[model samples]
Target: MNATHTPITAEAVTRVQAHYENVKKLGHWTSDRRFEVRARRGMAVLDLRSPQIPDGDIDVEVDLDHAMVKLLVPQDAHIDHWDLRYTGRGRVKDWTGENGEGRRIRVTGEIRHGEIRVHRGGVATLSAMFSREFVQDVRRARREGTEPTVADPARSS
Candidate 1:
């Protein structure tokens, strides 16, 4: 009989711990399995659902071998008007490598007023670039710093 096994290293454990810590800090966890936050407009809402993540309702996995991360967003959620803005000052080498040859991207999907807007990264490249941008922003914020501001342009003069 032949058997195969995968060993988990200290680094892996640390990564998992860090990921959970970040998720908690991001307000992704709530008292209820799912929580809803009202948007500026009475017509829109932002819902933060949990347990669904552990139940496979949403699959967010990271592959270190491939140096890739994947996130699956549900369709029924009423996420109206989602904008992911990235602004940071960091050495590319700090995140990607010492040579600084990695590309960053950000992609966001929002459904508002019965309309869906999918902002894809790598708009210029054939491949998906949004992932890189999104990952870089998150990692940078966790390591360096982050300034998050919530504003409703529709209500602004």
Candidate 2:
């Protein structure tokens, strides 16, 4: 673990599973998790429906091959898509990682004929991201060093 005091990666980093088929759901990641996923001809969804991350950033790498992945984070999540590489026609739709900032969501990955979609599917309205309250809350959380309100990032079920 890097002790740099950065909430984005302050504590330890956890690597999640790699999917090959079927439908896999990542319930909720409430911490600074280095979520690694590889989906081949399969589907994976980052569904934080009932629960929310609330704070901090998440590091992710998706090795997708002819697969479709949907990232349904909180409407307030700051998606900082740092690295993205694709081959043989890959596409990202409605992904706000390019022009978004809040609780950083650092996403990096490679794909081949795959699609990664990021959407605000939670309770937040379409205009919620631009609200003053949402901005203040995000700033406060970033300043206060908000920790995880859910389970440990390293514990995989």
Candidate 3:
């Protein structure tokens, strides 16, 4: 189980691209205030429930083409994706909408035949649990003979 995880600092511009491949950015990975995601005919998951996230609005610039991108955010997070330009059935599936409080996630960009799904609260936790990364972590823990980070309250060191 060789997983490549990128460390995103508070001042760095984190970018994740998935072209004809699946990309999962989960666990307790730190996140920057701004992100750039490009998904073309592939699947991408960006989990931002880490405590290292800045205390303010988060901006995510997406460029999607026949792809699916899922964002796992904090329960108190308020997502604002109205600024996204859609073409050919591209849309954002957020049931809770924007509640106007907590950390605001501003999404802006163009999508062509793609979708962006937002998971918050318990839904987000479930999404993180039922993932390939989690499976790898569990397997690694069993091999290393130690408690998996998945059992911890926070998925951090």
Q: Which candidate gets the maximum TM-score versus the true structure?
A: 3
Q: What TM-score quantifies how close candidate 1 is to the native fold?
A: 0.17
Question: Which structure is stronger by lDDT: 2 or 3?
Answer: 3
List TM-scores for all candidates, in order: 0.17, 0.59, 0.81
For residue 12, model 2's alpha carbon misses the true position, in angstroms, by: 4.7
Please identify model 3 stretches exceeding 4 Å from their true place: 1-10, 98-100, 139-157
The TM-score, computed over Cα atoms with residue i paired to residue i, of candidate 2 is 0.59
Superior by lDDT: candidate 1 or candidate 2: 2
Candidate 2 lDDT, tens digit per residue, 27-89? 343433556778888876654432344344566788888888776556566666548898898
Per residue, candidate 3 scores C-alpha lDDT tens digits across 1-157 of: 1132123345677899999999988865664778899999998888877666756677889999999999888777778787999999988888787554567787899999999999887888788778778888789888999655432224554
RMSD of each: 18.7, 11.0, 7.6
Model 2 residue 52 CA deviation (Å) reads 7.1
Clashing residue pairs in candidate 3 (N, C-alpha, C atoms within 3 angstroms): none
| True lDDT of residue 85, candidate 1 | 22
Stretches of model 1 off by over 4 angstroms after superposition: 1-28, 31-33, 42-53, 58-157
lDDT of each: 0.22, 0.57, 0.79
Native RMSD of candidate 3 (Å): 7.6
Q: For candidate 1, list the clashing residue pairs, or say none.
A: 104-133, 105-130, 105-132, 105-133, 106-130, 121-130
Which has the better TM-score: candidate 1, or candidate 2?
A: 2
lDDT of 1 by residue, 1-157 (tens): 1122122222211122222111211113222222221121222111122222222111112212111122112322222222422223211111111221111112232212222122122221211223343354457556767521111111111
